[model samples]
Target chain A: MGIKINVERTSAPKEKPEISQLGFGKFFTDHMFIMDYDSGEGWHHPRIVPYQQILMDPAAKVFHYGQTVFEGMKAYKTPDGRILMFRPYKNLQRLNRSNTRLSIPSLDEGLVMEALKQLIKVDEDWIPSELGTSLYIRPFVIATQATLGVSPSEKYHFMIILSPVGSYYEEGINPVSIYVESEYVRAVTGGVGNAKTGGNYAAGLKAQQEATEKGYSQVLWLDGVHRKYIEEVGSMNVFFKIGNKVVTPALNGSILEGVTRDSVIRVLRHWNIEVEEKTISIDELVAAYRSGTLEEAFGTGTAAVISPIGELNWQGDKLSLNGGRTGPLASKVYDFLTGVQRGTVEDPFGWIEKV
Target chain B: MGIKINVERTSAPKEKPEISQLGFGKFFTDHMFIMDYDSGEGWHHPRIVPYQQILMDPAAKVFHYGQTVFEGMKAYKTPDGRILMFRPYKNLQRLNRSNTRLSIPSLDEGLVMEALKQLIKVDEDWIPSELGTSLYIRPFVIATQATLGVSPSEKYHFMIILSPVGSYYEEGINPVSIYVESEYVRAVTGGVGNAKTGGNYAAGLKAQQEATEKGYSQVLWLDGVHRKYIEEVGSMNVFFKIGNKVVTPALNGSILEGVTRDSVIRVLRHWNIEVEEKTISIDELVAAYRSGTLEEAFGTGTAAVISPIGELNWQGDKLSLNGGRTGPLASKVYDFLTGVQRGTVEDPFGWIEKV
Candidate 1:
């Protein structure tokens, strides 16, 4: 079924922020994509309306039950003035997966993609042209049912908002220090950890705050059950280069299947580099570091394509990787991923979609 | 500091629903209590406003990161027309505990109690007079900062809304069948299971839905690690009567410290009944059932006060407790608790507060 989205432009648009000063998710475009879902009607009334405050009943399930899901993607403005989105379909697919896990209604991926492209076309000027800046796209769905029950909501609202963001690393691709959290667990095998829902992120806030207070940029969470295996770092998937093999935590039931993680694995295989998805415990990592086999470590996500780990503080024992600098593998992965995203490198994997 | 609340009464009052037809959380009162919290300003602008829709930016962290906490309580209209609240201070303390765990700023409990009392007084007419009917109070705090990051929100909105609710069991106190979920875990130790936050509820939606589909009223969640030890049943704390002793899972790191659970323990001890809070595994429970010692089982929460577990389905085995009827102990506890809440019984423990 074709979805006809009604467009309503803003009459009075606000002043655009300076591209150099555009922080993450602080500013939104003039218009946004919205659709409503009822119990029987499914998803309906797809539209592009002027961005404004949303009115909801105070008893909406999102407020009390957190029945919501979200996706993060970006639309980049190429040097030649073409707009490109890196693996947008993967984001949509993961969004539906999240919806399934949260018991929210599924959306037509094809229709949502069409609506997204139209929305980007309408607000194409929002895309930043700076070296690393791009228009961040946030697609989210929230339960709007006005009830006070701990169950899946019968009503929902799906919305897509755009924000012009500056470079993640203001200075450069600097390696960040990480604190390995032993107390707090982000997700468990049978929990909603694999889904892109708010609960998983909310559960990590305390650990993240503690890590920051300890002079760490992020917290590396261990497995929930044993509290031994490395799960993920902050909101990103983590990778370790021990000896010569690039190893990441296998797609366990708890670890999120990040789009950037998948792309990096594909690119590494394309280059014929040995990449393995396996469970690497903290003990193994510590032993590898002591033996001088842990060469480099990095996190992969949309915000920062590849964030190298410089220092790791595991229960007061600190290990500095690659002399506390960005390693060659991390740098290469970052450069290649950003190059492909910005249209500077050849599209060998057909990962970029023109908008 | 004294909070001078601004009162804005509704001009056109809504028609109150029929007392006999008032379902759970179906009808709202005329007014609600609201307060705002800023990063530096602390909590301010306390007010009693007309119950209505709330306006918020789409980028609010509560919608994206699930930074929210809530409390459920009720105002009982006694036979003599006095409004009674059972252990309101305990609910407020638990709310603050939830805030601490979620990284949200703490609220001044004394000031909040003042607001709640004032609001309850203003909407006293909405309290239904029928048996087992009362005015349900929902107090919640949601992160309202218009930013899209997975961290604690700097701005929050604390609101209390009242709903005239009918009895959870409209016919009378009835036993419910429970499904022992072995696949999806509610929460794990070292997670947010102990907190009264939205994320914990959102994580259990899938399992709850599955249990409902399997002809059960609620899902009995086991420990996330072993999936052997009993944790909670649906949103309530579970209790089991084996032989002559009442046993419940101890206050592990993951189980919520339920106010009703604590009260029940107190009342049980007051009656000189043998009660122990310890780890009770499913195997032990099954063995007790086979040995004819599992005499009764019940769930305790604010909503139902006491819900007797008539049948439990663990994998393929089914255990019918008390001949699938409301056990004598559950009946007596429910009557005594409701009697105290409604001012029909003497308050020896001083759990009731008057509005």
Candidate 2:
């Protein structure tokens, strides 16, 4: 299918924010990509328009039934003045999986890839040149059918917006505290857990808020059934180094397949380190801590890349890892991942897609 | 808090649809209610405006995180031309519950009640006078914060829209078939299943679509963890008559507290019928069916009131209930509920609130 591209540039562009003070998702570029999908017409009318409000009927299914899915990746400005995207095709593949689970129509991968590159090229100046900052790209699809029924929508809108974001942490590569959630669940097997959808994130806000109240930066969710086996963190996939092995919760149908997680595993394997993907229960982690074998724990995602976990509080029992400091393995992984993202390291995995 | 009311009437009134042809949630009334909520400022500027499209930023949290909740109810037109809302306060209370679970600010029940009544009075003519037809009122709240983070939104918009809808079943109250879903799970005990939010419905669309393709009217969801305990029917709560007792799923954390389900339980108790709310697994239901004690099965919700189940297909085995006809108990309950709603029968439960 041929995608006829149309461009309508914005006449009055807004002033850019200070690169030093820019926080995550606080500002957007001048242009965005949008395409519509009718039940019979398929996806059509791909265009780049000014970043502005979207007008939709009040009875759209997204507002009532939450028929939507989304993917998050970033565009990096390398030291050599080149723009790169880490594993762009993986994000699109994950997006298609999400669409299938949410009953949304699939997109043409080739067309979407072309659209992404074009949109980024148009707003290329929006890419941050700072050491730790990048342009966060959010691609989402919403059910736009104007009806008040509990069914799959026949109309949809797929949009891509660009936001110039600063580093996730103000202080680079620092250790943060995480609260082990014993009550609320993020996802369960046989549900939409593996899909990068809005509903799964929406269901986690209350627990996240509670963790924030308790002075924890994030919540480490456990499985919905047993509430003992560890699941991924609400924002990223989790990893723990016990003894000589690194273990992450397996992709048990409920854990999201993070692009960063896959990259980290590949890097570890390339370095001849043992990385196991299996179920790691909270009890086993606590036991490891007791046995003095829990060397390092961290989370992996596109936003922060690698966030070290300094302390874990589970049911009021606090366990400090690496004396509440960043461990050697955690720091090494962080430096290596950021180096690969910024094009300072050799491209062994062919992860970077140049724009 | 003083809620300043404002109203704007539409200059171009829409042509009214034929009452006989009015389907569910297709035609809207002339006006709608809207309010805004910020982090520090509580819900404010409660007003009724002309029904129109809502314009939102592309990066709004609701479009990406599914941060939305909605309530459904109806306004009935009595023979004397008076409008009555059945248990409207219950819906508001339930909406507040959903808000809390979604981390949205709590709504002032008293203020919301006044707003609902005022909006209904303004669009009183939109209420259908035909038998089994009424005006469907939908109240929803959405996170309007323009951010690209997976966190709770600090800004929100609360709105209410009305649609004149005919009876759910055009051919009268007939029994429908249900497919017992064993592969896809809707909600688990530790998740946000109890809240009437959009995510739970979004997660069930795939299963519902598959069931529809298999000649089933709806998918009967099982518990997310066990995948055997009967949970709900996605759009409504399920009930089964075994031997001499009525059994519905208990108020587990994963089951929605439906208003219709509550009213039916109360009415059954008033009639001196044994009503039990507990876990009724599919295996137990199948055993009851084999023993010839399955008697009846039905679903309860605001849309259909009571939808009798004529057959249930679990895996590859199909069991017919009441010989593919509506049962005596189901018919009696439907007539009594409709009669109470239309003001033809004395409402011993004081469920109707006049507008």
Candidate 3:
């Protein structure tokens, strides 16, 4: 990378929160990375500065048009004091992919990688070595143009914020119940569903709130067009095991191409478990449950690498899965992923990058 | 109203721009209305402050989750020196409707109306009295909670910013060519399409940019599920006069319930012209175009009011209407609507509210 990044250390660093008290996305580290993008000048003046508030115009495009994109990743501290990140370059690639769909300018991945490693190095003391704790990294871009027109913004701000966190869920590793959503549609095949943008999450909040009020942990989304095929599980890639076969929805234009989903499939194949990616419908799943073939269901994402779904409530039919317990396969996959992330297990696929 | 609103006037006012140079949304007035909403206190601290930038945390929910809603209205400086707003109470009601969809807290519309009137009084000098000039008011609410959760934020900021503007288009009231977009989808039936939210506009920017590159003024969006029924024309409700009948897309839980759209239908029916609000497919319009019954097509919204569709290019087959000029029905509707807005015609529907 030929770019020069200016680093400004914090004069008065705040005390780090207790590891046990650190929930998700609440406590930020001392340092963060930021850069600005102008229409003609491109991305310039990359800097690692103290964590602070952002002052933007009241009429910024992001506040009005919701033109933004983001990526979620984590960094873990090993017992021997080694720091590791799982497949960060892939996340940068996905971030650029999302930026393209949102009409924001694409960032130089290599240069941003340099900036990220530097920021993490400056804030390395903030990494907690607790069993389930890691430094959650959020890299996002927002439109900064102070214009009200609906076109693409001429200005943008790219930022990376680090938050020390425990598990994403209060339930931790326990399997949770899911509600099969029928009335609300998340994204269509021709929309921005595949892209990890703000709108997709915003669209899912109502459904999630409704399901939570009904005592479900999350809502499983169906396809926007047919409303039959399974698309995702509460912003995560979903998988089901039926009749000794592991199945997940294919990388249709509407569902997100989850990074953890790919890793899980690769690991399962390495262990001689065949994984099939195709259209999965609720009716087919219900029939599988009736035939005693629906063994285990889990969701895969960066926040919760493997969320074992113990039950699914589809149209008032509560189908308890794996006897309301975490399946053996789900536990094995979670252990392998977390071990690789924490550098306890051997890196089989070269997914871990040293910081 | 039992609430108190503090007012703070700016000491040094910036020089106003020339009315001729006051393009759409490019110039802001001196003062703006602001209110804050906390989870426990609800909406409070209403004030009129000088126009300035907003200081927000980098992890504000609006930036990452797009949990926001907005409404657009304008205040016209009538020839009789009275400031008038067209159906502003209706706009406030619609704002609350959008808020409910986005899961934000409902606002007191009556209190907000009082604030709007006060804000207009303080910045009344910025309201341009030139031909085709008025003050554009943008009322919006953005999630301000400094957390990275996918759920709704605990805090919000409701704001009203005014911009003195000229006509929306440099083309004035001339007819524009529209490209029928068949690839990208704006929204779906079960989604936030009916709400006046930011995500809907963000999802359509790419198509609009592509259409502009192809020499079209805007893109005509079809429904997401079928991709054949006409949904909207560049964020505006569309209408077509064919075979002595005026047809617009019905509010099918997908298209927006536009204020201008309702006004156009009422005016048409009030003048004894038959108007129908039903599902109008692209094939039906094309068939009407082939049989020489597609007399006029125009879009209705606050910005453009009445943008006549002179030509429609559907898959390289350009269908010219009214010989690529404004049709009689479109002209009549535009004239009558603008006349009532400017207090030039009788207020038959009582759609105007004097400030």
RMSD, each candidate, Å? 1.2, 1.3, 0.9
Which segments of candidate 3 are over 4 A away from where they belong? none
lDDT string for model 2 (A1-355, tens) is 3667898999988888899767888799999999999989999989999999999888999999889999989999987789988899999999999999999999988898888989999999889877778899999999999888788999999999999998776555689899999999999999999998888999999999999899998899999999899988768999999999999999999999999999999998998999999998999999999999998999999888899999999899999999999999888888888788888887888998998
List the lowest-lDDT window of 10 residues for candidate 2 chain A.
Answer: A165-174
Residue pairs in candidate 3 whose N, alpha carbon or C atoms collide under 3 angstroms: none
lDDT of 3 by residue, A17-118 (tens): 997788789889998899999998999889999999989988898989999999999999999999999999989999999888888889999998888889
Taking all chains together, the TM-score of candidate 2 against the true structure is 0.98
In the range A1-355, model 1's lDDT, one tens digit per residue, is 4668899999988789997678788899999999999999999999999999999999999999989999999999998999999999999999999999999999999988998999999999888888778889999999999877677999999999999987564444699999999999999999999999998998999999988898898899999999999999999999999897999999999999999999999999999999999998999999999999999999999987899999999999999999999999999999899889999999898999998
How many Å off is the CA of B32 in candidate 2?
Answer: 0.7
Better structure of 1 and 2 per lDDT: 1
Give me the TM-scores for chain A across all models, comma-separated: 0.98, 0.98, 0.99
DockQ by candidate, in order: 0.82, 0.85, 0.83
Ranking by TM-score: 3, 1, 2
